[model samples]
Target chain A: MNSSSSGNVGIVIVSHSPKIAEGAADMVRQMVGNAVPLAWTGGDIDGGLGTNVAGILEAIETAWSPAGVAVLVDLGGAETNSEMAVEMLPEDRRARVVVCNAPVVEGAVIAATESSGGSPLAAVKRSAEEFYA
Target chain B: MHDAHASRPGETPVPLTASAVLVNKVGLHARPSIKLTQCAKGFTAKIELALAADGPWTDAKSPVKVMRVKAPQGATLHFRVAGPDGKAALAAVLALVHDGFGEV
Candidate 1:
């Protein structure tokens, strides 16, 4: 929500419902404070590509570049969409992305919020490790 | 059968075996803990976490019991099931833990 942090990795949360994406981001903000960059793809973003493979690719091109991005998504469309995005990512950059398994909103928030101070890849790995542990 | 066992009353009884793995990440957060406790509530079993030998094992069926434990990543937990379906229940839980609650 806050665009002030310039160098941090961009985290995108996708859900069928915009409200849910907001809720997930909000939870993360509450825990670590608003010091990370966040964007939403599924909720209110124009074009159906927000949660789709194209949308993820666009977000990567637009936001991740110098710093890679991490994505957390809800169930249903969000899940399949993340998987598709993974397939589309270039093999070299694939390591930069991660899909969390926190169970919809909870997982997204945990992944996005925890993605600060460390490498975006590390944050995402930690989230995945925690969720699966 | 009763007479045979009674003849050896002084002998120690064999302990029952049960095992469960740590399923939830973040080491058993409230939501998953509640879910596990609710599942344990259905039947009567002496459920307890196999904490470090020095640490006391807590009841698995109690939400509070699970909350007290701060299990981290890759930690394997054990459950003591003793009831009608103790063996079956333990087996199911073992499978769930092995699967990492469907996440892994």
Candidate 2:
């Protein structure tokens, strides 16, 4: 099931600060190149420091891959918002997504690298979660 | 202690082993640890790495265990690999370490 150019898994990063999310995405890109799909969203719709369900949903769509998608977020509220965004997706798509419990930056980089190697959603999530281990 | 030349008829030879000092400034940090783990996963050998000469060995495929070594710069890392591809795996890991994980 080829999706993007690389046909590997994708990653979505969510953070309370736009800069933090963008920075983490950039780090992932630097480490993994363009072989993996990567998208990120942060800050509220009004440009404040907070999470937005709509922005996260759009990011997930932007980085969507038939292989699957792993969402990494910063803090509990961001995680909550990310879960809500995933729930808003269609059942078929939602089932293919996972909200990883890992550090945002480290998880993004590790997930992207594993995904670039054509790992499945579960493997990618495990790699990211191992960041805490 | 057993004689170095002594060997049983069906016993497998001892594992191939090597040691190298971590020259990278950050030692086995997150990025380098990930790289090492990924490389180790490529081989079917049972690979293990220890921080010191006689330190406890941990599975090289486990990123968490590798990171837990916390080997700083100039710390010697000993590797023991046992399997069909043990020799090749040891060489590959040694090469990566000698290259300073491409950090320098």
Highest lDDT, which number?
2
List candidate 1 segments past 4 Å from native: A1-8, A43-50, A61-67, A90-92, B1-104
Please write out the lDDT profile of model 1 over residues A1-133, one tens digit for every residue. 5443656666777777767766776765654345567766664346433356676566555546346677777766777777788778889877777666656555554444434543456655465346546
Could you report the Cα RMSD, in angstroms, for every candidate shown?
A: 14.8, 4.9
* Interface RMSD for all numbered candidates: 12.8, 2.8
Q: Model 2 clash pairs?
A: none
TM-score of chain A of each: 0.69, 0.95
Q: Who wins the DockQ comparison?
A: 2
lDDT for each residue of candidate 1 in B80-104, tens digit (9 for 90 to 100): 5555556655666566566665555
Writing each residue's lDDT as its tens digit, candidate 2 over B1-104 gives 34542364432368778899899999998778877877887778889999865758898876666877888999899999887677888999999999999997
Model 2, runs deviating above 4 Å: A1-5, A131-133, B1-14, B53-55
Q: Tell me the lDDT of candidate 1.
A: 0.58
Native A-B contact fraction in model 1: 0.00
